[model samples]
Target chain A: MTYTGHLQLEASERYGKSVLSDAYYNGVFKISRPTYTDENLPLVQLIHVGGGYVDGDTYLTEIHVKNMAKLAVTTQASTKVYKTPHKQVMQRALYKLEANTELHMKQDPLIAYKDARFTQETEVHMDQSASFFFTDSVTPGWSKEGTLFPFTCITSKLKVYQNGRLVIFDHLRLKPDEDLMQLLQLEGNTHVGSLFFIHSEVTVEWIQKLRDYLASFCDDQYGVSLLQIPGVCLRILAKRTSLIEKIFAAVEEFIHSTIYNRSAISWRK
Target chain B: MAMTNALFPILQLSDSQFPSGAFSHSFGLETYISNGTINSSASFRKVLEIFLANQFVYTDGLACRLAYEGLEIGNLEQLWQLDQSLYALGMARETREGNRRIGDRFVKIVSTLYPNQVFDQYNMELKNKNVFGHSALVFAIVSKHLGIERETAISSYGFATASSLVQNAVRGVPLGQTEGQKILVDIQPLLTDIVNRIMLLDETEFGIGAPGLEIAQMQHEAIDVRLFMS
Candidate 1:
């Protein structure tokens, strides 16, 4: 089945209290009502009614955060791409953030089962003052025969634009057909995780701290580097899925405690 | 076949002694050596092949091709966009900085020698710090400016990149100079093969994934002592 999800979020201030003025979603996507903590932060969970994607599926999601609003969007569960023999699955998302707004997308990992071909493209358009923290992981599902990473292909591309100029364009396409164990490819890793933080307020100290935090995990191979823009990009590769999950958890906590000066709550079911 | 007038320019730019500061950075080879990961000839060759097939062939080759096309159409805006895209594709900070440094140096030297209006405009952009000047793009721009054919320009670039890494391996991995030459000879066929492949590559295939090599370059920054910049 073909699925397309669209969401638009706007903020309104009444009596000096920030509220979700407009929260809308269409098609196979659903979002929980905003649960505001003491700081008026809205935590929204994106839900897929059909659980996962199949052949010839197309999904598009648009998110807009108005000025001075803070929002975080995550999935209800991992996105699974089942085997596709006839056609590929495609997903695209666009995020627009106005000035002084922040959007954090701590999405669950995308799992591609054997022979599954999946393509995802996400682009962010924001002002210079806006901030974004985005993360995504990719792990292949095992086959009945116990083989791993048997998926046909996975293409994921991310681009960030500020003031109409492209600042970051990250594209990763893995076709595990040849030389997969080489030093330049996955290096025998079964799971990969990537995190991008683009905020004008980020500092060198935060980057270093994040690097140290990533280094503390000995089971995985990770790296933290400053992006060309005012932000950092972290990449982690490990054999076990839990290792990358742990890294993501730590990263979410670090951003919460260090950058936001708040504590992160567990949203896991 | 008639000899091309651009042949000399291609040869000159392809020379290692052209002084683009290409030798100063090892492009993460130092880290592999420091970690004792690439100490033998076979290992060095394997890693070099990985570098070519996985990282350099896609990233640098595609950027170079795009820059050449952008310049051919005299589209400075397109060139700027391509530069930004190439910069964004770099996952390691040092890789980004190092490429910019080298590109800046190449433009500085070649622009002075050639002194063309196109080169001047690009130099102005670089001077104004509007966009990051990457090595591959600069190489392409200069090659195009010098009237070099696209195929010759790209193949020369592939060879130069391979030679630079091989030479660094000779020094870092401490491989015998003969062993280094042999390794280069072994990979000689791949130069044409990769350049041919890159020539036909689509823009969608521009930045093929190389997560392991990227992490290694990033880890290069944290090593206590570093011989090369990247």
Candidate 2:
């Protein structure tokens, strides 16, 4: 038997300020009090009410933003998945960004403990004019004997559609069977971070500058990919979670200040 | 279609003179070569193994297997979706375009050389822009039409891929011809191993590979001077 928790949130701009006009969550899920740090953008924190994820735990999340609206979403804490000898923790998120809308999703790292398995998929449909920013990380959790990759496997997938045409699709699976430390794989890194940003304002020049900026961090291995559509994805493989997050945070700040032409918003961790 | 005459076409198709346009792309080799991670033939062979094991086995190899089965069952929709998934899963734009170009070129060349209904249908889909054809899928269909054995088709396909990279390394990494052949010979068993692994993979296990290669391929796009497209 499996129970599926669901969260639906919608936001729109009213009187020049974004507000959470509609929100619903049931079955072991809740949202923290709306935090307004940008004075107009509402930060919605997803709170898993029934504690950490376990075997057979599944969740569905839907986020929508009306035309001209701006919204930010993050998790209250790290997603911890314990031993799942039988079933894997499955999570799905759907996003709909109307024309001229903006959505930023910066969530905490997912920790896959010993003998755990986790899979997450995100699908997004947005108009050509909409702007979307999302970042995620995967980190190994605790183990009795202190193994680096004790989890069974961790899988993530993202598919993006602009104007009903699939433009970006990224699929990643990390398992112990393959040597993740190889030059063609993780390059001796344990933590993985990814950033996906889609905006009409993206350009070749911007991507070049961003790559130059990231190249300064010689200790961490990073790659920035320009989407066929108007966006970019940056993936960083680092030895520490802080290293990964630092790269992501720097890129995020660059996007905000350089691309969005505003000061970066503090996640307020 | 296996009228004891299939060997000639398979050998010709796998030959380096086929003009498959694989020479124009090094996948992610440009990045590694420029960054000094793949200067020697030895290092190139090591990365090639990783490529065979991590990326190639899961993506193109699996797609070829699936396309073969799909054709046997007369399932065209699955092939269409397979093409789309291949395109979508290609996070790096250059690698995506490179493979797509090679796939489309295969469709064009094979249609004239050995006409088949599956090729016609795939050509139609390509014309409609409904699917982004892949070389692996196209070759599988062609192999089926030619009555080539599954293992032969897979092995020859893998060989062509490996051969092209080695050939590219001859110019990019500047390795000797004998050195290139050594790398090719070295990877033969690994290719067989990859095929064995691909046979056991489930549909859900597709697209499982290292992000490091993808990142390297992505970085190739930003390099100031690039010999290959990918």
Candidate 3:
């Protein structure tokens, strides 16, 4: 079965926020907030109910951030994808931000059990004044023997559109049997995460600052660089998923404290 | 006689000593090593295999073929379009710059000896900042000018690059000279397969699933101390 949900947020006031959907399925819940209180940055929570079915297969979530607004979206719990006898689970998230708006979205790490296949695609559109920060974390699943799957594949793509034109495109395909952890590949990193931030007026100095900030996490193998366009991309290849998640959390918090905080100070009062 | 002569142009263009500065760039190998992903020769060998199988087969090989065929029919627009598409497909700044740098160097070398309208025009465009002079595209243009067949040119380019990579691995991994040649020989069959695959490729298949290499190349750019120009 296929399920689809769409959420849109338009900020009315400085701290006014709206909840688009907070629905729960067998064990999986679809929680989204289009707007949030900048004053407190309330944490929206979604819990997985025991005995509930947790099938990420054929699931879709879409989010739209309107013009001149700010929104931060995240999940309350680490998502677990249970293995099934017949099919692999699939999940996709889409984000759209209008001109002069900002959207910061990060998902808690996902753990996929043995024999699980997952495919994800993220599409982002940013106007001249628009800004975006997003990340996705994934972990391998275990088999019936309590061992990880001998073979697993994950495919993901991130497409960015600026001024109605395609600007940056990123894609990753991983297969365990193919020796993906080799140096020429993911370099033996079990956990891989990508962070993309796009802003037209962003300068090289700003990118260097962000890079230095991300580099402060000393435990993981990470690299940050500027894309061909006016944007910055950070890729982390680490031995542990938790490390990557912590780094992502830290980055999101930094963005919040710096960018959002400055805006709040200027326009809030 | 025609076939033998056809192979000659390929030989010259594919020579590692062509002085295009390809040897100076590890194309992210240095970064991989510093990151500890490539600790020994065995690991480096594995990485090279994956790189040849995934990246070179799909991207540079295809670009060489298209540019060669485009030049054969005097399709400048097609060549320009291919260059633009390559630039767009190259996500990393260093990788894109590497392509342009090698392209410009190749054109400079060819313009001194061959001196044709096509070369002049492309060189002029590159000078005016109208288009990025990508290495594969320039190879196509020069190989066509030298009267080499499209298949020979593309295959030779592929083989030569694979050989160069093995050579670089030899130095980076510090493999013995004999061991390096052995690695090249072992990969010969795979190179042939890749070349054949390149010929059969469609344009839509370009730039498919190369994030590892892209990320590595991007990282190579910021590597504080590096031996490669990439």
i-RMS for every candidate: 1.0, 1.4, 2.3
Provide the fnat value for model 3, as a fraction from 0 to 1: 0.31
Model 3 alpha-carbon miss at residue A233, Å: 1.4
Name model 1 segments beyond 4 Å from true: A1-3, A11-17, A217-219, B1-5
TM-scores, in order shown? Answer: 0.94, 0.94, 0.76
Evaluation by TM-score, superior candidate among 1 and 3: 1
DockQ sort, best first: 1, 2, 3
What is the C-alpha local distance difference test score of each model? Answer: 0.81, 0.86, 0.66
DockQ scores of the candidates: 0.80, 0.68, 0.36
The sequence of per-residue lDDT tens digits that candidate 3 reaches over residues A1-269 is 44533333333224454333232333234443323454533233334433222344465556666655566666656666665456655566666777677666666666766655666677776786788777776676556576533326666767777776556666666667766666556766677788876766456676667667776656466666666677667777776887886776666566556555533211111
* Per-residue lDDT of model 2, residues A1-269, tens digit only: 23468999999889888899999988988998788976468988999987788998899999999988989998888999888978888999999999999899998999889888999999999999999999989999878898989888899988898889777777889887777777888888888888899998888789889888877765467888777777888888887888888888889888988977777877777
List candidate 3 segments past 4 Å from native. A1-35, A39-62, A76-94, A147-151, A200-204, A207-217, A257-269, B1-4, B33-44, B62-92, B104-131, B138-154, B166-182, B196-224
Per-residue lDDT of model 3, residues B55-85, tens digit only: 7877777888988877777788788766666
In the range A80-168, model 1's lDDT, one tens digit per residue, is 99988898998999999888888878888899898999999999999999999898888988788787678899999999999888888
Instruction: Between candidates 1 and 3, name the one with more favorable lDDT.
Output: 1
Question: Which residue pairs show backbone clashes in model 1?
Answer: B28-B230
